[model samples]
Target: MYSNTSELAEDKLLLLYLLDKIKLPISNNKVTEIILENNFINYFTLQQYLTELANANFINYIEQEGKHRIIVSNKGLKVLSLFRNRISEVKIKAIDCYLKKQMESIKKEIAISADYTIEGNNYIVNLKAVENNSILIDLKLNVASNKQAKDLCAKWKKNSSKLYNELFKVLINN
Candidate 1:
């Protein structure tokens, strides 16, 4: 249970602090996961703070190929630099621990993405794989139905690495 004013302040600072440490454009889902895992704040409060931070120009929300990601703005970095110490060291350590454990899963999610859109009678599915700032794969396929598009996306999420490997093998052997 948190009081209104102090709780809001702490929640905002904690969100900023987590973003600063992660140092990457992360999805709202990922941020929610970390906050919930820590159990410091409720989900509703976290969403409120995230909105407030973005509204204040402390963070920017970007949609890339249909994925929503948030990054700290220059203003955010400055604010964090000045006030990050206000957050307790214990909290910082806890965030660090959580990030360390979950980084691989985070990377896995960010590395591959799938999206679909309807064009006339068909669905166009766009599947992508990125590492660092480089695009490793950009594939688009036309499917007959929305269900097919959706199933393709689910399979892509699960079997992207294997698919990529097979693709590379065929390309190289040809």
Candidate 2:
């Protein structure tokens, strides 16, 4: 989508720099949200850049728990180190500030997750909590209706930590 070679290269470097700063595997949706929210690049252009970066071994895309996640490759870090100056200091500072403000929400987004699927006459809800890339809790429930499943997921997202602590207390007391 970019007509200028330098611009394309610089944008790719910008992405790499972002991933390096994150230092964690990020879901595709999260990456898209950040880039689009910042108005750094259009959706189609971002897709193309992601594909090119993955193909060139500059970024690694992996599927886990049915989600697509991306992380910067070692080669990408090297490239960023060499070309990061192409990205303006203003852009870098903006990213740093934004990350600082949103890192907690981002971590919660990555760590707490819930989803549902229809199974026969029931809805199967899956709720999970993760820390440091390790599973802290994984719970599945079979509900009679979609509304029940949705409510369960919402509650799980909001109260998973409290529930986990309570569950732990109950189990230990027994």
Local accuracy of candidate 2 as per-residue lDDT tens digits, 35-64: 899888899999989999999999999876
Q: Model 1 over residues 112-161: C-alpha lDDT tens digits?
A: 99889999999999989888868889999999999999999999999999
RMSD of 2: 1.6
Clashes of each: 0, 0
Q: Show model 1 residue runs off by greater than 4 Å.
A: 1-7, 145-147
Candidate 2 off by > 4 Å:
1-3
TM-score of each: 0.85, 0.92
Worst 10 residues of 2 by lDDT: 1-10
C-alpha lDDT score of every prediction, in listed order: 0.86, 0.88
- Return the lDDT, model 2, position 164: 84
